[model samples]
Target: MTNKLKAFIFPLALTLVSPVTLGETLRPEGLLSLRELPIEEGSADIQRLQITDRSGMVLVDTDKALPLIENEYSPNSYDGYTAKLLAERQTKITAIDLQGERYDLLSPSTRSGDYLLLITREEGNGAYNFNLRFRYDATAKSFDLNQVLLNENNSECDHSLLSTYSIDRKILGVISIANFDGRRVFGVLKELRLAHQTSGNMAEKLMPETVASNFDAALKAYKVGDAQALKTLVGYFLSGDEDGDCEPGNYIVEKYYFPQKVGWSNDLGFLFEQAGHYPEAVELLQHITRKHPDRVVAYLNLADAYWALGEREQARQAYGQYHEKMTAAQKQARIPPRVLERK
Candidate 1:
């Protein structure tokens, strides 16, 4: 990305999980698992799963709803439990607010300790109901469902909800959905508050200055259309070096870091495309498409970049993907001349 590198200050709120020191390397055993539980043969449609606490205790079992008495930690152990359905065919389960309005349910639950957050759709109405916070009470050994209402009540726009649930150093972060015109790119929203934590009593946690400095160098390299510098940046992050150490291969940046910037690299790809940096644009745009397969614009950009580079097959595939995902309106609106004239 050529724009000046601006450090993202995380606005975090702490959840009331068992207190562990911040930055403490939590053993893998001390982490709750929210992975997709495996499915049985011929059970392709069934989305059964399990939620376990950091101590490897089963807190919520979709197959067997409520009062998880035994910790049967097996993907196949859910045979006896009834899988809780999030939606019915095309419909979803939602809730009524004080105003008696309906909304769509959020997806891909967020879990921290004994607490699990799930968003379900309200049937008939295509909007989310509310954020369901289920806390596992050890005393009762039963799960309690608590309703966390969303503050915004703009019922006119039919707003879509997308969530990226993350837990970083004792903090749970859920970025909401942000739509951009025809793009409707889904990512972690700007709200920046920790998911499942209602309290917002935290200050901005800035990225280390060293990390910012390294990113600045990468940005400078990007501005000048230097492929070597771009590759160096990728290597630096993947090399497993400490955070902020930019030595050729000594910085620790998660591969997901760039994708999470939400439209940052996409904008940068346009810059590179305009500058005729086909190789650079192709590399960056390819990364964006892989990170967000639904972002059709990224594919369009990649198609253009590839076409410019004379990689005909790659360009054709990119163009195909872009065209396949386009809505009827997008297909009719401002058709790409290259798409129409493709050989």
Candidate 2:
């Protein structure tokens, strides 16, 4: 993993006329619609979406946040389509259709725009979930082939859903999620340019060693309170060329996606918290819980930040959840009781 500035290259963006050359692929006639999650069964606002294209209609999957469209039309390849997504901030179900399908939709004629992939839960029980697909495309930009993905489901009901107009978002999160042996939420890299490769099982065969090597240099610079070094490292994070498949690159990827859980903006919050930027930490962490309820950890950490800032009840709520995530044996491994006491 030589960091001597690997001469990187970005791919050309796809044109509307870019040949859809897989000969056997199905022609998309109408708009395809998907949802984030299903609304409560009996609620007045039963959520749904209606997908139709300028020509006709595409397939729809009701309950899945990401739907895999099995293509009988394509041959000799894993050719299918999914309106896949990851959890994120400021999520809204927007609408639902009679078929119990949730949709993050746009007008039938809107050509290219970025879309937010979200999920909606039934208001009452929070039971059935559906995909939330919203268009966020810009002129000329198209859908990414790799959708939001999770390395492991970590059993966290709500996971972070991240999306950037870029293709490398998930590669960086690799380290952060692995740290807690937990799952992190991220959108997939459908852009052919990124070229991410995945396996049914990928916890092993980690990223190359060089990514870590660069990360170590950056971290050392960070510890010494070097703002310039921190800026450079942070620059690597926000860049579009990260990969989780190698080492220092993996380290770069991980820290970029650090605070690694899915509930809220914990990724950003963690960085702020570490720097004693409590106000920002509280604000960002609170954004996660308020906007994304499934990120249980955000609530707990929000409490920590709140307590640190001397905010009581909010801290208590966070501590309450934190205690539940702990075990009886772990509890006895004792720190002060009130270290987590809300009040």
Candidate 3:
């Protein structure tokens, strides 16, 4: 692995999470838990972040069939409640804006231990009350939070359309998946804001917030197909590594006072690859191979990266090794006419 790849992975992996304070009043936001009844598990992307105990919440834009747009547009004219203390569960989540229209929240949890927000609204006849239940998970150290309806269902345990997480004992940071490309950019912006809040006025000194924002922005750049941000994030990753390995900067994370985890590594690698950080991508893929020797995606991707850099021999070797494990059908399914065009 190269020093750059090491740098890229270390800080991110190491900067796990700290207890985040949610609600607009607290500023950058954190965990969520709706208690009255229970919110249903709608989708996997949302459910992926949700464990048995904690999960971040996001409002799917029912109108646009998208995640909430991150534009500077004003919030909806819908009258609702913004509470820091507690939320009621007697209300119903409309087909319109379920989460945000019903509730608005921060995305990633433990983003440098920043402040988060929650905005809940009731559509049409706001007769029933809403209880947004949020439970904290000390193990993963996140939260399980969701929307709840009070008056529905039988005496059953939250079988209604309440928002519930599958996470176990981990505090969940309310989050959303905007259109992948569009959303990543918005997510990076949110990341910067959270870092700024968590920096505790150390923005200039530790230059605290710049690091993560830069990392995420690079991902966003690639998402929109922006080459520069992609490269910069790659270079930043490289520069951070004095030892050419992906570490998530756990050292710095510990030194800087933050939580740590292997979370987001593959995703981070994906951003690097999308941004054309092939060598860095290769290093990241290699990192994953150490743990999951059977993941063909990593090897296939790494080989491609090697080939892109004119390292034909290395690429061939990687491809051959991974190809051995692939079924003939799998290989045929994956190959494109362009692959045979390799020089």
Candidate 4:
């Protein structure tokens, strides 16, 4: 295995064995225990489980059609039979939901006093697993189905979802990992905001509120030329002191900070330049150009910043690149006069 694969697999392996316990009851009042109902003779020996209220109304049932396992296996074979047996034996229940129903609930804090129940079921010869999430509603005195997460591991590749919740911020950060090519891995982290008050369905309540809020704040700060405010916003999202590979702090920047805005680094560079912070502008503009080379406009902004910093040769090179990329009409009509002069 490569280092990147090891980085992802090792921490996950430790989490599976040493789960972080939240020490809170996820079960709400009126919802009875999760009980396993006996399988009928014609039901093909598959165990059925149900979550019922005090009034015996079934809220969730594993016997019903499940999204992941509906068409996964064929009927009545030794391999299929053994798969079901393994699934039943390996089924796990936990307070937090993540990683194909693995029991670990890793988070920085859980002070929101919310409740969640997770049930993970293995399917189809132990290659696929499904995690069912249930969140409690205090007002209605019931549990709401939140999400169904999947983890698939086979000879070809490994694909899974990992998540963490920040109760104070009311943000749910999810990381999706896809390792299809042997040495190349791709991962994306998305931060979702939960409702302020847990009254509605989780699907409807989850949104990118924080992302919007941060973006608006940053824009406002830039418009007002408030360098201090912009710096503070950057610190909030980008600061991390953790030591290790694949650390959660590292992803905080990746998910909540850098990816939220279009041409974010470039915009920040402009904001810094307007505020007379020439060095910061040069650094940020250079970063964005390297990170997103296809963003043609960044070259123009970078050239101006370099000129402001008295780097004449570098500024000329950037101006030349921008001049080459612009259409004839743009070069004549839109290109800044200083760019043509400098190039």
lDDT of 1: 0.42
Q: TM-score per candidate, in order?
A: 0.30, 0.27, 0.33, 0.38
Residue 110 of model 2 has an lDDT of: 26
Of 2 and 4, which scores higher on TM-score? 4
For candidate 4, write residues 123-219 as lDDT tens digits.
Answer: 3333333333344454654444443333222212222222222222112222111101101110111111213123212321111334445656867
- Across 17-44, the per-residue lDDT of candidate 2 in tens digits comes to 1113234332332233333333222222
Ranking by lDDT: 1, 4, 3, 2
Ranking by TM-score: 4, 3, 1, 2
Residue-level error in angstroms, candidate 3, position 3: 48
Question: Which stretches of model 1 miss by more than 4 angstroms?
Answer: 1-167, 171-257, 327-330
Q: Which candidate number has the best TM-score?
A: 4
State the RMSD for candidate 3. Answer: 23.2
Looking at candidate 2, what is the lDDT of residue 153? 12
Worst 10 residues of 1 by lDDT: 177-186
- Model 3, 229-258: lDDT tens per residue? 576666654433343443333222211221
